[model samples]
Target: MFAMLVDFASPVSLDWLTLSVIPILFYYFVYTIYSLYFSPLANYPGPFFAKISSWPNFYHSTTGYRHIWIWQCHQKYGDAFRFKPDGVLFNSPSAYRTIYNSRANVKKGKFYEIWPRNTQNINTLTTIDKSAHGRKRRVLNSAFSEKAIRSAAGFVSEHVDRWNEVFLADNDGKEWTSPKNMSKMADYLVFDIMGDLCFGKSFELKEPGENEFRHMPHTIAEYMQFMYPASMITQSPMMKFWVWLKPRGLDSLFESMLPKNIRSYYEFVEANVARRQKEEEVLKRSDAEEGRGRNDLFHYLFNATDELGNPGYNTDELYAEANLLIIAGSDTTATTLVGFWFYITRNLRVYEKLVKEIRTAFDRAEDIQVGTTLSSCNYLQACIDEVLRAAPAGVADLVREVLPGGLEIEGGRLPEGTQLGVAQWSIMHHEESFGDPWTFRPERWIADSSTGVTPEDVARARSAFNPFTIGAGNCVGQKFAMEELLITVARTLWRMDARLVPGDNLGAGSSKLGWGSRDKNHIVLRDAWISIKDGPMVQFRKRVD
Candidate 1:
């Protein structure tokens, strides 16, 4: 029987290689034609290659230009465009609401699942089920309550005060300190703050002395770079195979593939969580009052209760959420601070105005805490708003999958099973929203008739501005984030005078960075869900009376 089968194939000289290649090539050709002219999304405009495959999205992600690529497409294609064969991206405020609002007929895109280590590791951010997300969010909300925020403010102040002193090192009050990379400084400060709050012990990345965890921030960035594009590949033609493989052995494969730095980050989070849990157990056993009085974020989460009054999270769940808090709490704040320094240092006029407002708002640096007095500083808030608008930390879309019955957006209806979102970078920089979108003008946020920024102008801009995004999936800790920003900027400016190192522009965009990101004044960011950025090298001097 084997000899007869071999003799039959030898007649035409047909080989396994030719037979396998023919079907794949033929299938791709037919699929491309259908995707370009026959699919529900055929009418959407975008790059030709993007209309047929997910490679464009994957390639741009690898280059750290995925956000820019989306913006460039929107510039050519108008408010809506196809980013992947099955994905559509929008560049309007209404579209954003339609996709992400609480009542929107959509859930998180499937690509979100690629980030979790396994089913047990899925946290609030990666959960695709709407009901599961809601349950998780409710329990997590306890950690960011009004009372928790008031307590968190104390931690913020402690870290910010120490951070400021570090800037003045190696300098006398009479002269400016050497040029410091504000990006790296911001990372250390925010990372330490997050470590202290979430783990009950500061990583102390900001201190002058050596520390083992000093490279953790860079490790986190490296891990994001690997995961972001890998997630995008889940939408490619290999989606089915990838999805099937994940539960079988891909989890172990990914663990093996991670670089040493990335592995170290995982080990660090695991160690910290284990140590904190043991400490909590001791406190609960010996001194319940001490455990109840502990005000770190982990305390709230550790003590959180479900509707039935059971513990909200188990050990595995706690370990998973620890990663979430570190990235969400630290990276978002640090990215904003980096962008703020880039703009404020270059624009001296704006810097002087902000300095006057901050100094006048508080009598001493210690007075700049989270309160009514701090909240009243309009310029400081405007500055922060402008930073978010121009250089948002999460520049890419928070993608979602259309549910059954589809969604109506921007004067058209999308079919069910469509993956879509608003490109945050494109929408925030769109001309329809901000007349001078490329300019860094905090005054755009302040409603002043004399400056020609009328209430209507500010309202229109506010409608389009969603740095923390909106609706159910919005940043759960937005108020806490704002409190940190306000305190960091206000206190720093109150104690020190900052200026750009002469002719240094490490983070600013240039012509070489390609279209939609060429303005020299605009700060450039590499999107990795959260942003990765560099410097606006700056020098600071103590404010003389």
Candidate 2:
């Protein structure tokens, strides 16, 4: 039977197997050739290994200090450096205006294409089409308008009670409460608070003064690390080809490699979206009655329609935007305050100054509500802005690619399709940009002659600091996020006495750019998330009062 089968198949064909090998070799040959000659990136200079190959750049990004390395490259080369075969590392301030500021030609890269939800409509960040982004932004614009935000502050204001509870939770009397980490507790409070306001979904992350959830921060840390590689690999046209030919973005195969702590995260926003859709029909019917109130972010978003009068957020759009809100509203602000809190916590002097200012401003924690917390706290706003500039949730120098016509930036010629942008971290730290760039001088934020800072200094200092970004291409949610950060930080300071213990440090995720605020990798020193930020750590016998 074997002989008969072999005969019928005309024996083993080395030809077929050999043909497959040829294509495999040919693909690499083409890759190598283009990587050398025809590739438009051929002339650009980069690390010798990266210019010759893609492995070095991809692997470096995966190793966790990708920001440091990119900063190194920008320092070594001039403003624009070819990071890999396709992606370029830029460190020029003017590059920002060229790429992100100019709206006519550039839109977000398709590298963000994989980010769109398979089950939902495209989100603000994922829309590669300019028209779609414009349309979505227009509809979403009114919700974040000054009037709308002032209205929404009502929801943000309510979370302070929950926050206060966390502060006083386990205080039996002690010093610095055994080294608690503020990041997690702050995150739980922020995430749940934002989730409730945005989707009416209560994650209940905060209880008294502690976080019920541990997985959220770990999940987020993992997700950021996972996405960080894209800045190197996916942004590069060459390496992206290699990855695509194989498997794809984070699937089960990759998820299996992560620690179980990271693996256990629940998609709270996703679950909430599915849960909320049922209520919309009820809301629409109740809309007929005069006193049947239906007003919250969820209601407004759910009821909002497109230009054609179609209801806001078809099921797909609903989930995507809600998921985005969970990410946007919580993560950015939490990250900002975590860094801010870390800085003030370590610098007892700054913390004291902030405390005095906050204490005098609010009669009580309850009175220091969101709107009032932000409005009355001028120094608080300045400190928050300084923190943001020092350690922004995202370093600006946001990239924009010059399309067919090319962009002429800072009066210099940039070829068509040059991907470039300024480095916010570098600029913010430049000795020329900030005096004694390494020191955390919150005094620079205040009007003071003690630091030798003058009115002329303030006027000239504008160029050195561009944290929320400037101009038309700046962050869309800047106003809302700013209000939230200031209120959250000031209110926390007003209620709790945050102080850093000696020998304590921010973990690996922080950038150690000289004099810049510390960025931590976010490991907890002690307690639950909500408890850590509650502060003073039992040092006081009576109370801060």
Using lDDT as the measure, the top candidate is 1
lDDT of 2 by residue, 125-198 (tens): 67766777777766666556665566666566677556655556666534344455556666777787777767
Q: Write the per-residue lDDT of candidate 1 for residues 432-518, one digit (tens) a residue.
A: 889999898999998888898999999899889998888889999899999999999999999999989998979888988798778
Per-model TM-score, in order, reads 0.95, 0.79
Which structure among the candidates has the greatest TM-score? 1
* Model 1 misplacement above 4 A: 1-19, 285-287, 290-292
Count of clashes, each model: 0, 17
Runs of candidate 2 with Cα error greater than 4 angstroms are 1-45, 52-54, 102-104, 119-121, 172-176, 208-213, 239-267, 288-294, 370-376, 395-399, 459-461, 470-474, 508-545
Q: What's the CA error at residue 322 for candidate 2, in Å? A: 0.6
Listed per candidate, the RMSD to the true structure in angstroms reads 2.7, 6.2
TM-score of 1: 0.95
